[model samples]
Target: MSAAHNASYLSRIKPGWKFGSLLVLSIGLYLISSWQVLLVAFILSVALLASARVDLKQLRAPLISIVIILGVVFILLGIQTNWLNAVSSVLRLLTMCLLAYSVSLSTRFSEMLELFQQVASPIRVVGGNPDQVALALSMTIRFIPELKKVYNEVREAQHARGLANNPLAVTVPLVIRSLKIADETAEALDARGFDSAPANH
Candidate 1:
């Protein structure tokens, strides 16, 4: 993930506060049924990303993917329900997605890890290791961009080979490469004793 501009005001905010606000806003989006309000929210979300000085170049692929998915959703909802519901759903989701990307772009990975660790601390009461939980969650977030890169690379290679029309051509390599990456990450974490509990003093 690209780091936010150091001088950006949003970069100075605490990760916990940003994450909390994102959670609240996401929940609130579901309660909103008016497309007009959602459109305003979408505008504000874009403005938030701009205020954070997020790199739009880095977001190109993800934004394209989101647009495609949203398009499909719009068509399906419009047919299954009503055009109004489809418009509201699309606006709500797009706004939430932009808001989420804003937070991720503005926040540092280390700060996010710290926040996740704190939030997962309660998992210890149920025989779960908070450190592992935090690491898993943090790594998952980190993997998103990596996976996107992998997908693009695989897709391009398939396209060059004239297999662009074959879904399996893309799916097989992407899954294989993703698994390879996951395996390597697991090995690295194990080498660092990431899964081991600290000994009593």
Candidate 2:
């Protein structure tokens, strides 16, 4: 998490409320077809991120990826349908991604884990381990940026070796490193007796 995110008012809001609102807003975005409304929603999402006071620099990589992906999406949709449809699709998706990222940035991992556990509690009735489920989800969310960092490091190293464009060279090391991290995490959880503990409601 960014220091700026910790200092923002959005950080003080409950994770459940922020996530709930994000879900509602995302659903609303999907239902609205007008490009004008979608554009406004995208603007509002940007404004929401601005209000959170998160450092834009931290978002550079993800923002770049989003732009590239959305550009491809726009082109494909325009080819299949109309340009207006492509515009609306891009705006709606971009808005949702921004809002989701904003929520993730502002909310702490502990808060997200607690919220996920609470939401997953009903799984216990079906003989499921809600704590494990919640932990898995939380860890997945928490490690996304870490994985991205690892990927960049691997890419940079490969680039330095003049193998930047070699898919196998990049992918082999990334997968190995990611699995190593996952194994370490599982061992740490086991040492903490996470599986032996009762679920916290």
Model 1 scores what on Cα lDDT? 0.86
Indicate which candidate wins on lDDT. 2
Candidate 1 lDDT tens digits, 1-87? 546454588888898999999999999999999999998999999888987888778788899999999999999999999999999
Between which residue pairs do clashes occur in model 2? none
Candidate 2: tens digits of C-alpha lDDT, residues 175-196: 9999999999989988987774
Instruction: List candidate 1 stretches off by more than 4 Å.
Output: 2-6, 131-195
Cα TM-score per model: 0.67, 0.67
Model 2, C-alpha of 1: deviation from truth (Å):
6.3
Which 10-residue window in model 2 sums to the lowest lDDT?
Answer: 1-10
- Model 2 regions lying over 4 Å from their true place: 1-5, 131-201
What overall lDDT, based on C-alpha atoms, would model 2 receive against the true structure?
0.87
Q: Would you list the C-alpha lDDT of every candidate in the order shown?
A: 0.86, 0.87
